[model samples]
Target: MPRMRSSSVIPHLLREQANAVQLYLQYKGYHWNVAGPLFRELHLLFDEHATTVFETIDALAERQRMLGAAAAYTLEDIRLASTIPHERGLPRTTQEMLERLIAAHHVIIEGMHEGFKSAESDQDPGSADLFARFVQAHEKMEWFLRELASEPPPTSEVTGRSSLAREKGVPAAAIPSSHAAPPFAGPPLT
Candidate 1:
């Protein structure tokens, strides 16, 4: 095996660590603010996922230490390194929160793939393994969110027409709807 270079692998670890911190904070926010029919389930799930993500931070930082670099810890350092998008404010609906979480997971998973490749090419099997394991956790969390968001096709109760009718180019008159689709609701106030 080729000798490992900290320069080749530490950047990947730093980015992953930053992402983990951001994701963990986002999960905590959702866990605290989520309110709806599935409140209990979503609340608990968010908290559980947050805890899992939080636990990985230490391992990530320690990996950087083993590679002879100080781990990123300050908010400014994390903010600059993190790729996760910041949430504007509290999500108006639980569904929106799930969507945001799913997107965050996607970002993390994408970064992890790159990190894993870099580590593998640099002959750092330990970091590569770490990336692989963490990406799997993110994937599992995304799966849960996707499953929760899935629902049967949306059909208007009065017209008995599926929502996709419009997209499919079916004549609107053929459906004979008395009601228009609900107007777009804007973001909630802080």
Candidate 2:
């Protein structure tokens, strides 16, 4: 079988590169800003994911270079190429951050699926393999986030009031006030 044309694979590689950079930055933002009850766990998770995403950026860029195309380095170039939606501001809760990260992973996974198909059909095994591996990584990350997002709020052990008491027929006031609100639910940092 004939090898795929460089033109056919380069665009997909470049797009992935841009998405990786954007996702890395978003992860870092959440990592640095996360606070409240689950702050330590969420912060550590975000930073770890950010590092993983950051590692992808170089491989994606090099893949494009191997295809004989110029790797995009300018901020404007990445902004234009990335398909991840722009954020209005920092999320109001850890749940919101988890939701956003899950959605972003979905976008990247979908794009990788398309890119993988294109590369495989074009007989480019290397590019297809890269897409497949990244897809698995993104899927794992998404699953971790989804698990966190799906968890029910903790019940207050002392008073038996759930954090989601208002929705569970218990008086909201009975819930623990200590975990009522996120510590950083304020204006975006300058």
Q: Report the Cα lDDT for candidate 2.
A: 0.80
Writing each residue's lDDT as its tens digit, candidate 2 over 1-190 gives 3333355878888888999999999999999998766677788999999988898899889887776788999999999999988777998777778888999999999999988998888777888999999999999999988876663445333233344643443333334666455444568889
Which is the leading candidate under TM-score?
2
lDDT on C-alpha atoms for all candidate structures: 0.80, 0.80
TM-score of 2: 0.79
lDDT at residue 55 of model 1 (Cα atoms): 93
lDDT by residue (tens digit), candidate 1, 1-190: 3333445888889998999999999999999988755678888999999999999999999899888888889999999999989878987767678878899999999999999999889778899999999999999999988877654345435234335334433323223344445445669879
- Clashing residue pairs found in predicted model 1: none
